[model samples]
Target chain A: MIVAERKPFDEIKNMVSGYKKVLTVGCGTCVAVCLAGGSKEVETLNAELNLAFGKDKIEFGAETVERQCDMEFLAELDAKADEYDALISMACGAGIQFLAERFPNKPVFPAVNTSFIGVNLDVGWYEEKCRACGTCVLGLTGGICPVTLCAKSLFNGPCGGTNQKSCEIDKDQPCAWYKIHERLAGQDRLGQIIEISPPNDWSNQKPRKVIQPGYEERVKALGR
Target chain B: MKSGSNLEKILKAGHFAFTGEVGPPRGANVEALREKVSYLKGNVDMANITDNQTAMVRMSSWAASIICMQEGVEPNFQMVCRDRNRLAMQADILGAYAHGIRNMLCLSGDHQQFGDHPQSKGVFDLDSMQLIGMVKKMRDEGKFLGGADIDGPPELFIGAAANPFAEPFEWRVHRLAKKVAAGADFVQTQCVFNMERIRAWVAQANDMGLTDKVAILPGITPMKSVGMAKYMKNKVPGMDVPDEIIKRLQGVDKKNVADEGIKIACEQIEEFKEMKGVAGVHLMAIEWEHKVPEIAERAGVLPRPEV
Candidate 1:
């Protein structure tokens, strides 16, 4: 899932400093699951902000939607748009962007730092798993990602910084290429690690948008 | 005759090669660089001009390499993928080639967190392996990475770094083979303090016939003090400075520690020459460039080949 973390309280406070009435919108999907921008978090932030700014003549409200990325769920804020001077979006970058598109006139601010697409390792611990590099070589790498996991993102093999099964950059982190090597060796596929991968095709540049033709055709045929 | 570099000529002639490093000045001043290169002119075959090494901003390696050429020494231009995109890298390659830089060392640079500007974004559009392959493609195919035709591709003697002390130690030689496959003409390793580990890695490389494919120059850094030795062992990533070496350094008086370091470096170089498949010793004197001549003389790599 798309992971995110709350921005510092000072930065969040500064973003809506002058706004008299502020609305904090939270996403209930990824951010909620990560315990970052869920309904409970939104309420806690709202109460904190109100307590901090009450003497400064400011009011705050909190609400959460099913998924901030979808326009359908975001439409729930339209009726309350006129009640607040500004809005704080506690969601991933994509959700924040979509929220801004929904409320063109209202001042929309992101209250979180969109980290990466990762899985929860444990409670409050997340590790990045994918880079969405358009090309996936997991089949050859034995289900490990050298692209996102290796500090150097080396395709052919690990850099000289791997030490005792950990990365040389940070000893706490496991070396991705080492893990891939172990995985491939376990499967008796060590030969795969030596094959030279061609230069990465970066044609799928950033801010990328995709359209599923089959889904689009189905929607069009349904005439909905 | 790739790049017609002296280093390449010496290695091609089957003579033991000796390369030295010259870090560009932190500022734009070239006098300090010239002074450092002076010590290396007759003592080494080629000098590696570092590119923002350790992520600290310095004069571009391209410029420093040209300065080396001006000082009558061949330069191995070091490039890291941390600071530039493909367009910038290609442009610099053409510029460096035009300015007479024949050799290039491709590296995945140190992470920015270690540098002065930790807040900066790293532009690793290509990893070191990909960069090596890209440079080879440009030179051999006479085409850019995007397959665009170049009027004249940069002819370079490609070099890459290796670290024998890094973990999954058994895989080091295989990684070196991969680099050679990616188009490295030669390989220079991280500083060697653990000779046993390096000897094992070299033996593996010999068994795999990798030593025959690419020239391998093991890195040697003279320990300036016991503190420096401890720092390398504890702080420097991928460096394996054995505890015995640190203890040896501790045995020396503070004033004689630098000499002890040089003595150890000389011993490593001598042993490196006898190792099968070893090409040369890359003496990285760091800031003590003045001591390179003495180190080279003591190690018997002096009177460097003129080829």
Candidate 2:
């Protein structure tokens, strides 16, 4: 679901201008799935860089690790750090930070812009969804996420911009407000749009520096 | 044949030249293919004999090229490297040379997964670029891909595929340049329906100096039906099936889709004839080989060059 885009070649070239030996590392996770920073893209980038700055001008290296997010993956690179002058990470923003943390001395440049977590509409196409605001509002909005659709992410009521059951911003697509109205209308509770709800508490949901636990905790406890 | 030989003659022959492709018939059945070539004798300048097209098991390209030559049709042998290793590829180059298949089109064959034999392991020991380089090495240095000396190399008029509408269009142009650098004499692109995209590609090719060195033949295929057009747009990679073409097909009566398809294809061919950097058109009708002459005639691509 993670969406990313490759940085332009000119910028990438400038980043590795002084480096004699460069390792272009690819992540086989979200970046790979989005086709931005996959193994093939890494190899192509390597070939292009070589072709641009003659093969003799740069001592280039390339590899793809399992996942740049995990410490285990970073540990695998311990044996080959000396062979590279700098590292270019083709992973999300978080994965790049993790790599930078692991290899403090080496300069690490991001090869992709971490766009958003979303769904692929077609092959090689993706649309943004779920801003990851550290809160879940699906219970009131139904399974169809209004957070990504709403012009203002207003959980309280339907916005005034809903025209002819379509969003004013994009007329081709349905309005989130119209959907909430329909849901309320279906349940014989048409007045739900007018129902006042308290504003979302921003103080209690401050961004934290650490992700305490993910899916691994359940697996570790089960020992499967 | 000397330097700048077969292709130079072919390119100069110019407009209205007809060509047809023969996907070598599988198993001990050369009769059908030979007959197809014979039918094309008075109509076409060359018969593009394919090498195991669609990843289907078939007669070798060199074998088919030799058969076509014997049948009085100049064969533009299509050679793919999906099934062969570097050794086999190099060996085949020499073998095709011995059999007199000078007009060679290099292809990275269809994946085995798409074919009936999905279990068969694909040996992509070298991609299209590597194969082009290997051929150039053999022809220019009189040596195999392995740096070993050869007695003499075949004089190959090399052609490679250019997929303009492939994802990341810039990369396709880069790939075409790489093929050119690898000594590709000409290019035959994937079926082009979107003329705007083709025009852009032609511009990029011109920018890359490919126009001067390589003759680019944009591949064209007629839309048989609305369903077939939809299927192709959805399934075929490197194919640009524009909306107008779809609407054009949809406007036709159900029974007349084939004729409509031919009309559209002929229009594209005619338009492409005047396009800059476009040397010719490579018509791929799949199984509908008979319509090629009609399409060519309609497109005003007439009078096959004197053989």
Candidate 3:
């Protein structure tokens, strides 16, 4: 899931300081799962902002959508768009961008920092699982993402800093290459890591867009 | 005679090559580096200028290598994949080469958490092995990492680090073999305190014929005191300091611990000299550079070859 964390309190306060009426929009998807932004988080932020502003000079409200990325769910906010001076988006980068695109006139501020696509390790613990590099090599590395796990993002093998199966950088973290080696060795597929990977093609170009081929044809046929 | 660097010449001539390390100053001050280089002059074959070794910011190894060259000391330029991408790495390699640096050591470097700035993002675009391969390609093929032509290729004697003491110990020699296959001309290992493990690793390398493929230089850092010994043994990851050595240090008087450390280091050097497939010794005195001359002299690596 696309994980995110709330921006610092001071930064969020500064972003909404001049606004007299503000709406805090939360996403019930990845941000909620990561405990960064959800309906409860939005209420907490709204209450905090009200207390920080004091004197009731600014009115704060909170709302949450099923998924901020979906245009249908975003339609729920269109009815109250003109009632608020500013909108605070407690969603990932993609969500904030989508929200901004929906309400082009109103100022949209992001309340959280989109971190990475990761998985929940335990309660309150999240580990990055993918870089969205657009090139997948998990089949080669026994399903471990070296591009995101290895500190050096090494594709070939482990570096000299692998100590006791842990990373030399952060002793608490297991060395990604070490884990890959162990997994491949256990599976009797050690030859995969030994083979040098060609340089990444970097196909994840910026602002890239893709449309489902059959969906485009279906849309054209259904056109009124 | 790769790059014809003094270290390479000494190693090629079958002499016990001695290489010293010099950490670049945090600021732009070159006087400290110059003094260290001058102090190490004639006492060692090459002076390795570290590249922000533990991730603490310092004068770049590329600039320090040039400074060392100015001080009449050939430099073994150390580069880590932590700070630069492939483009920056290839550019710096050419820059170092233009500055007359011949020997290059590729390392993955200590994590940023160990350095002063733990928050900085690491740029490990390529690991040490890939870095070695890239350097090899640039030098041998006269092309950049992306396979673009260079006006003049850098003639480099590539070096890679090995930690025989690191865990999954069985794979250490095979890792060294991979580095050699990737174009590492020589291999300098992590500091050696466990001689039995090092001997076993060397034997494994010999069995794999890796010893003949690349020159293996074991790293040695003389402990300054019992505290230093404990830190390396316990705190430093992958460092294997045997109990007997700690006991030996603990047996000595507080003031005599430094000398005891030197004595132990000298013994290790002597053992390395006799070990099969061992090429030389890389003496890392840490901040105790003044004692390197004494350690080298005591280890009979003095009167460095004038090649």
Candidate 4:
């Protein structure tokens, strides 16, 4: 559920200008679900690029390889490496880095801005939920990820900053703390608010790097 | 077959030629259009009547085509998919044909956001290619898009649009090929201000053998003024108007730009006539339909191709 916004077409066009043979690689998992790096989007971008600059100016190609993190899916692009001068990735920052790692010499550019992951409110609209903070606070926050909702990421109960159950930044939006209070009241555990959370640990950053073991076996088995 | 309609004869003839379009005014007034039809009746072989062009609410292309048909003018009814589905499209095509609106142009219209009704829901159940395929299926198989068999298949002379000047010139030829394969009898391209680009597109089309398969009618729109030309270039989708043409229009006197526009259109038609694959020209004077005949005559299309 990684949320992302598309980069403007003009900016993307300029990024791949140097390369005559370009492969637009999209991530089928997260980015696709978010409507960023899907098959349809890749097709549209391909068309846009072909229209702006003739196909001769840029021999553009498009393919949505599976999860960019999975080395197996990433290997699918290896066959096309010789055909492209560069790869334009339509995935999150982490996925783009993975692609860059896979094809060291070939340059990679991102066509989408990797925003926070969440659910779509409706068609062409999205709402942010998880921030992917390694430290789990759901146990204390009554299953609500306060890190994503709270502007201050307060682990404890209602902050004094709340004005009449509304967030300070946007008065119309109900304060995350106030909503947490309502949830706690319903659970008969308002006392849990007084239990202070420990100082946030910075070591959670190391877990961000996803490593898959026995990757070569999987790559060959998958026949990528 | 002795109905011998002008549109029928044109389709039967091998030479693909140019055409021009005019959107009828909003209201019911008919005098201005009458004047235009009277002037263009014999001058230009056919004129396209636009249907709620740009998704903007306006007088129907169907009704206007009916008027022009009665005036002895051949009309290509421009049908857009923004407001209708296969049902409406099929019904409209049948109705237009019944009313002698023989030539039909298929288009996936401009989105509602660009039009007056930004809040209006768009019905894109079928795109231009699907519409082309549907019409083709109807003609070839005697079956409607719904698979319901008709007593007799429609003998429609279908046309679709290709934007060679549409940004991404590489896919222009490919998209046109799809249209032809889908069943477009001919293509009325986006406006052509830059002949070099048009030549490139035509060359691509020829290389793909698409030029031999479908009639390619290059489009020419008379520039109202330098301002209008600039507006069109900046605003219109798939419409590419060169800077030199704008510069030429700018150099002319503003009051006489209409005449200059007609002159430019005539010049374009004359230039297109020399090209090998060009079937004809599609003139889009928009509201200025009266000038088409004069432009055609000036471009040497007036003796009109032998029927």
Candidate whose lDDT is highest: 1
What TM-score, over all chains together, does every model reach?
Answer: 0.95, 0.57, 0.93, 0.58
Every candidate's CA RMSD: 2.2, 22.6, 2.6, 25.6
For A28-110, candidate 4 gives per-residue lDDT tens digits of: 88888878888888998999999999978898898888789788999888888778889999988888999999999999999
Candidate 2 clash pair list: B16-B301, B16-B302
Instruction: Please report, in order, the local distance difference test score of every candidate based on alpha carbons.
Output: 0.89, 0.74, 0.88, 0.75
Candidate 4 lDDT at A115 equals: 84
Which runs in model 2 stand beyond 4 Å of their true positions?
Answer: A1-224, B1-7, B13-18
Best by DockQ: 1
lDDT of 4 by residue, B1-307 (tens): 3224455477567555656666776677786666667777777677788888766887788888888778877888888866886688898877877776667888767656667887886665566667777887777788987779977566677878776754334545766776777778878877788889999989888898988888888888888888889987765644567888888888878888777887888787877788878878887777666666667777887666668
Taking the candidates in order, what DockQ does each have? 0.63, 0.01, 0.56, 0.01
Error of 2 at A59 (Å): 57
Model 1: chain A TM-score against the true structure: 0.93
Q: Model 4 chain B, TM?
A: 0.92
Model 2 agreement with the true structure over A1-224: per-residue lDDT tens digits = 78999999999999998888999888988889889888988998999889988878887788888789898998988878768889999989988999898889999999889998899898899988776765566655554555566644545433223344555345576767567656755776544333333324333246564435786787779675
Alpha-carbon shift of residue B94 in model 4 (angstroms) = 1.9
Q: Cα deviation of B148 in candidate 1 (Å)?
A: 1.9
Angstrom error at residue A106, model 1: 1.8
Model 2 alpha-carbon miss at residue B41, Å = 2.4
- Candidate 4's TM-score: 0.58
* TM-scores of chain B, in order: 0.98, 0.93, 0.98, 0.92
In model 4 chain A, which range of ten residues has the least summed lDDT? Answer: A156-165
Model 3 chain B scores worst on lDDT over the 10 consecutive residues at B166-175
The TM-score leader among the candidates is 1
Candidate 1 C-alpha lDDT tens digits along A1-224:
99999999989998999989888999999999998999989998888888878845788888999999999999998999789889999999999999999999999999999999999999889989998888898998999998799876767777666677888678898989889989898899989878888767765586675658668887778686
